[model samples]
Target chain A: MPIQAITPDYHGEVRDRLENFHGNQLVYVGWDRHLLFCSAVAFPLAPDTRFAQLRDEAMAGVFGLHPEWAQVDWGRVSWLLDGEPFEPMLDRPLNEQGIGHKSLLRMQTPDLKGFQSAGV
Target chain B: MAAKKLNIKDKYRLLTRDLDWEFSYQDRKEAFPYEEFEGIKITDWSKWEDPFRLTMDAYWKYQAEKEKKLYAIFDAFAQNNGHLNISDPRYANALKIFLTGVSPLEYQAFQGFAHTGRQFGGVGARIACQMQSIDELRHVQTQIHAMSHYNKFFDGFQDWSHMHDRVWYLSVPKSFFDDARSAGPFEYLVAISFSFEYVLTNLLFVPFMSGAAYNGDMATVTFGFSAQSDEARHMTLGLEVIKFLLEQHEDNVPIVQKWIDKWFWRGTRLLSIVAMMMDYMLPNKVMSWKEAWEVYFEEAGGSLFKDLARYGIRMPKYAETTEKEKEHVSHQAWWIFYNYGQAAGFHTWIPTDKELDWLSEKYPETFDKYYRPRWELARQMEAEGKRFYNPGLPQLCNCCQIPMGFTEMDDPTQIAYRQTVYNGERYHFCSDGCHDIFVDEPEKYVQSWLPVHQIFQGNCGGPGVEDVLRDYYRMNVGADNLDIKGSPDEQRWNAWKGVA
Candidate 1:
């Protein structure tokens, strides 16, 4: 396993550190501590300091943190589902009949390599 | 020697249609098998006319040129420090997975097209199939050869042929295409040519090529764009197949409608992965899945389906399902990428705030409210010096290898998990049909090749994630390939952009 599992507490900490460390830039955060990683790339794996156990917790999902699914506050910005500029369109129907913005903006960023190997 | 340019207009004289010799020896029914299986009747074989009307001579000339261009790229990249030029080996993870999971389908297309060449009763259809067969093979070869440059540096490429057969998530596409290839030639055309080619071509080719354009993957961009030019031809074939079938006899309408319904859902479910890739994976996302689907499926396909009303064909059966999931494919695919990235040869990291803001603007409905909180909480965790990961094994959807986090269409809030108990073992499935398939034949499915399972089986470079990264991905530990690789296009891009 290339990663260690972490509790929600530690997972939360890592997310915070990832943001602050990079400021605004995208950076890596995982359940492993391996600074020995090569530093020559555009994006370097964030140093695994706080969760030293992550490197060993591979299948355990970084200490098995965040068990529940990522919850969505649907009513909050439900109108965004309507295909129009925000301020005026959040109130539009959500895939109400045919064309709506909410149905169009669904997005994902899969780790190129992670996706392939997961089904093993 | 440069082949003479043959005018496409003069196809009949060149094709030797005169050689058909009027089928003197054999009965027509024996020659054509399964024509009546669907109860469709064809009065005239001469009625069908290929839209492109490409002759063999014109076909090979352009094809040979495409190969010549591709091969030159291979030679240049290999001779130079192509591997050295990558922004980082981590970026290769995308390519690695792409080769293993998607490249094989190109070959499948070859087989399907080849079968099409022979099975098609008409000369025009047969010739069209012959052309497509060769093109598909070329796609597979070029993809393999171009990726060979990474072989010395990466490990996953070495195992794709093996992975494609055994992986679980791979089954989604594998089963989809397999289902089509197993069906009649007409069905194959409907499944791939129409459902996939016309309905979702933009989702597949556009993002891949456009993303390459944005990320500075010149070779990939060029190759992708080149291949897509052929896709336009395939799209035309797809459109005509449906239109021709429907127009031939009123009977074909129902069969065509059934196929449209069945295959549309199948294709949409399969594309969920690509949707995720576009919305999240691409550093420079173009349009979100929800947006693209709305335009492509709803606006375009929707309009087409509406137009079909006059012809007696109704809307896609699972149109509701597709419409419902459109808002969530990107959301789900990204989360899956983040959580299950360990076994993956590629790297997974969080999106930036700016990108999140982009998501907010793009998905005005669910951005800051539901999705934002997850990121916000993650941001808070990061602020406290932490990164999150799921605590336990995700409940796998029996149908799709994706986790059971996706819920029923009408209610996106609930996690959807449908189960079917067999003789002794209880099999978990993502939906009813997937359960039905598994129930029908369990052994065929148990032998799936999921990447995560492979990691546990020690099929990868051994237990360490870091080890897998180095061996499987040839990951530079942390890097993305961009201008440094100097894709032929990138070199030109800089020269044109007037940058030194």
Candidate 2:
């Protein structure tokens, strides 16, 4: 239902518009079933940043702290962009792959459950 | 002729309802401009019963007497060094959360009630709201006085009002009140007084007050006792407001129900911090968060909805979801805080072995299988000098402003991620309840001043996390935040106790 207001023309100004960020769009990445990290990590990234750079540089600093990080096989990892399954072009920029501002990318690693399969 | 003596009810009527004048020259609608904006039809103002009959003079006398007793105890608690008598220094962290996050809410309640009091056309409601507004003002004052004894010896208490405006985690409580205050008058009553005070208040107060009693904090327990009668009156007023609206016009039922659903969900999300406090922060434990939910919410609220069924009001929409979530929210919330302790205002730590066992026994269904392993790993890492802190910011729910840490009830392994696009911009929620609220009022929620989003946008002090924490948030680095193991709070307590 639309909001009931004194003025019929009530429209909210979007606070997190892409233009508000200085040359960066917000991207949220979560590793499926990994409760150890608590929640998805939100990053402000330039749209031209490559998918591989996000993996090897930014994600490594976060997911690497887990004891099971070393055993994960990257080749078997699957991805979901905004809840739809997608395969990212590793060397291509995120904007070219339809990843826009405030996009959620979830990564799932096969056969490597969280910390003894206890969802840790 | 002998003058006749008047009784309390007659005096209350003469003083309150008799003062309102007829709108002969002015338009009635113009006087109460916001009454019909939200589609509520109030057929008769006379049907609005006054919930309480205390006159303003009597109210001041009673409150002044209570203040005399309350301040004497606060003096005694301070003179005796009550800070040293707590079960553990860790218990003080809960007080920090209360002073910063909860006390300021009382002030906001004062503002809300005062504003809404003038907007209602019914003289009874205006008088009741005026009394409650005064009660709220007293509450915030007494709460501050009660916690000031701890401030002399605590780190996090110093910059609470500052942090509430700027900090990441404190935004959860801040935004909840901001949302309620900015809403229409009737909706504010349904949200704060009915849904929060009437339905969900015990879940908040019982935990804190009982936890204080158990943990040897007399000041807080006394404050709780002093506020008990006011809360009772507020709860009755809440019930009266709902019944008056529902009986006046049938059209009002659906609007009230929608507000109940939205507020109940918002209240449950806001109470996650309290859940963490009950389950983890209190050094001498009260009941577990799950047990408290069962007793206060399920048992008590089950009967409330049953009573309200006569007026076409059912249980809140996501109450079943909240029932399942009670088992996991405390653990999940604590994990989020522990992971981001570096950025928080209060200290966080892994539960001791005994507390862990208590949690396992309280939540036998999920604790051992899911949460225990994570804490065990944290303990192992702490032993190796690798205490874990997430080096990245968390995605916050666009409505609740809490990090999206809640997991699916059925799965508990997968994060419950719900998203919808409004006007080409995507918004995410931690659960269906928050998602529904956002979907209903996208225009209202899209303007949320999310702390993390603001930080990323460089609207906060600086680009770096440390810069924001130190300069913008005003937290004392290495003093107010991080794990409590070797912090100044722990060291000071150990020194005072002569522990080597």
Candidate 3:
């Protein structure tokens, strides 16, 4: 996937330097493959939020991304970068992990195959 | 008394063509500067034929007659207390949605068409737009005048002009027309006159008008009929523009094709609201959105595209997905409104027992399997006095500006999510179709006035929902809300029926 390839060495480099970072990031939090309503949810994140907090808020519509009937195991929920999974340091603030603003994330079932090559 | 009469066709030809002269005082390039930048070639402007052969005199006479008839009905409806004759108080919510979401679009079309009427390079095309501009103005006026009877007793109708500009849900229609309005003249014609009017007019007009008729809304039905008569001419203009452009030059084909692709997808996304209004909002429904889609789009539009195929035109890229979406869009859209109706100017409610049964019957495959359970949960919550509402703002799609609530294709359990990065900032779309539009014109869409984002940025009056709704959106609490048992209109309706 494009995201994983762009950040293959993500853990060693950005993850190490993330503790001091403080900036906002916009993200998409989605679950399930069948989009009964729309494709995904979008939220602009605050600098102080931990991944756990962000995850909880997404579930509760804090960032305004409420999908009815969506259920995800909060702990197991992974953030997708370019449709590929990234192991987010859940306890850490997003900026601490160098996940800067405008980051795209999808919290889907871990084993679901990503990105079908559908023609537009 | 015995004077020879001129043939009507010959007279039309003489009046339309013989009147135009080469610009003597003004430079042609300076006068019509906007049309050619999109690279659409039109070597011979005279090749543009208005099949309807409409001229100002005929248009004035026809439209004036229609207006006279429509207003006479409007007057009678009001004088006879026609609001009391509607199917239900809930039925006014459908008109509320229409007035709040759609009538402003007619006004916007008036402006867009007025621009093309002034700016297009061809006299025939310009005249067509000028006529359509007046028609659109008439539509907005008649729709408002017709709804004025309801507005006298209803809540949502009073604030549409202002609400359409600032309300979150209304941003969907506003933004779509704004996107079209921002384009060059040729693109505007293709976006609205061609794609919207010709290809998708039936889906928008038929259900609402038919529902109006079914619901004993004579005023709306009358206005709808009058507007529809004008729509026939608009549709002809749309068809003629496509053919005229295609036949102009070989190089124009690809440009027109791209425009067709962009606009067809845009138009479909905008019409999703209408789908919900048809299927769910109207208490006395005329037809399901899926059935309407099958008849108007898949069947009729399919044949029209086949004819256009000879000219190297094809259907929109996301035609298959759009077809798939018909089964679910109305359901999903209504669910969103049901959950978030409090924040809106119009009221929304869960479908009644008979209405739910109608949905189940209409959507045999997906309704029970996918939507019914969630609605059941909502029903349970309401029974327990919880009455669910999305307590927070919804994440709107970057393209359509609608809440991100659609499910994946053939998979109602999951969200259909797509994203693309441009200039290091990631943009999110609710579908591949919307994503494709963004990629094609990232510069244009990236600047979208996304309502949810604007709210978060403190640009929407203030940081809180109260300020946003009252100060910015101007939504009056009990009146323009979905407390079904508590609405003033509902109480008024009850008193009118002697139930209060």
Candidate 4:
């Protein structure tokens, strides 16, 4: 027998709740364990800005801690979604790279020299 | 280029209902490969309620706002030297447990939802899983951000991702998530979303958040409050999934029951860490672990199961024994951590005099009669400058990966042990609940990365203790573990108070 998944009737309070969702998600930028920046800025699902640009933006306000991060050669650092690196420049808009709301752009220096050429 | 005017109901319908397409180009089974074989019978795809009915636009908008507020609080707390503002240095261990044991599980749940979001036949269920996938990832980031301030001031907060993988005690949670992740999607939902989230999450999250408030860890309280609202929706999803499964077909009831039985035991074992953290680790107690369990699990959960009785679901197997264990499990787990602190990343100390008096008051049934005398001897040993460390590795339960420190139900003095032979190798469990899980799925469990066995096999750094703790676990002795008299954190706390 074929499987059939049924969606329940949506009216009344369920419909109302569905219509007005209160839990909106944020885009997070991080270096190691620190959350450098999380913004209400809703870049399009397919963003025009490059991942390299986002890294610079992460260092924008918190000059106290972020200047050191700037000196650390972020080009050598790989942008990660679970733990694996994705080349966000090639994938231009983050949506093209499977990056979405609540997705973490973890910065790690996996292979210092290898990442430099990968970005190039 | 203009803001589109769309009704919420119409947008939800467009996103969920209109998006689904029947597979005409390939076999449906080939397209969504893993949903079956777990024996859950879903007859009508429409019966599944997408409880949140959340669209990407709304999801991103609302969650972004909440996270912006949360990060602002994180910044304010960090700028003000919030670590120094905490009630006691010892209270940081609660956050340590959160980072090590709990945060990684959210990442695991993130992966689980990602898999289910793709695999489920129902569009509504798929959308829900997709949204929760994002929620779990946000939890991992927010929590790490919230606790990152302590990494500057405290030891044991560093190298947690490494420690979570290699440490002996940390294996318990790692192995639990591994168990859930390895299963089929429906079983994963049953194991985590229902059993862990619906039934037992309160026991883990609420008291710790309350403990954070009482202890003045504002960063934790902020993150906890942020996560709590999301958890309410997740809890509803859990209930909705279970009811949908049971109502879809009569055949699903027994399958659902078996999952409930297995996962409830699995999830309860996982919560032993929370129990100990509540009863012993919190410097300013919110309530005893027993009170929290009674209020959260027995009172609330009992009523939840009673409501589901009409669907042929009963409370989990071994419910009575689990209730009886409330008085004892926290002490046993904490005793293990206290004695074995050298092996762990966090500091552990015997309760102070006032704290012991509090334990005695809270646990009038079991503390003085059974646990206090052991502490008295430990105190004597500490006094004589013979600080006890277990020189030998402990025998770990094959299933739960907790040490065989749990006591017998009737005797309370004798250790509880259950063993089964599968393929000529004897495996032991700390309780019948674990033993039952192993027997039911021997093929799945026999391959468990039992940390003790790995040590004997020389997979963990090297044969020496120093090599394991230093090279493999990446933990420093004087800084990362309990010195009782003073570690850097302790010295800082004292120095801040003008103590010489």
DockQ, all models: 0.03, 0.84, 0.15, 0.01
Stretches of candidate 4 exceeding 4 Å from the true structure: A1-120, B1-3
Q: For residues A23-87, what per-residue lDDT tens digits would candidate 1 score against the true structure?
A: 22211122111101100001112233222221223312332343221322223322221123232
State which candidate, 2 or 4, has the greater DockQ.
2
Q: How good is the docking of model 2, by CAPRI class? A: high
iRMSD (1 decimal) for each model: 21.5, 1.0, 12.6, 22.9
Error of 4 at B67 (Å): 1.1
Candidate 4 per-residue lDDT over residues A61-112, each given as its tens digit:
3322322344565457666663457766642655556665434455554443
* lDDT, candidate 3, B245-345, per-residue tens: 99989998988898898889988888989999998888788989999999999999999999999999988788999888999899888888887767878
Q: How well is each residue in B1-500 modelled by candidate 1, as lDDT tens digits?
A: 95586454445546734324456898766776645554556666667767556666777898888878878876887787565554433345556657876788889989998986676667766777777778788888878887777776554466676556655456567767776776677878888888888888777777666766665556666678568768888888888778778878888887788778767766777787788777766766667878778877788887877777888988877687777777766776666555544434344556777878988888887555445555555556556765544433344544455554455555443334455444333345555545545554454444434344344445656446566555654544333212122333334435544768
**Model 2 lDDT per residue over B1-500, tens place:** 75597787787778889979999899988999988888899989989888977888889999999999999999999999999999999999999999989999999999999999999999999999999999999999999999999999978999778888888988999999999998889999999899999999999999999999999999999999999999999999999999999999999999999999999999999999999999999999889999999999999999999999999999999899988999999999999999999998889999999999999999999999999999988888899999999998999999999999999999999999999999999999999999999999899999999998999889997879999989999999889999999999999999999998
lDDT values, one for every candidate: 0.57, 0.93, 0.78, 0.75
Candidate 2 regions exceeding 4 Å error are B1-7
CAPRI docking class of candidate 1: incorrect
DockQ winner between 3 and 4, please give it. Answer: 3
Chain A TM-score values, per prediction = 0.16, 0.95, 0.53, 0.48
- State the local distance difference test value for candidate 3: 0.78
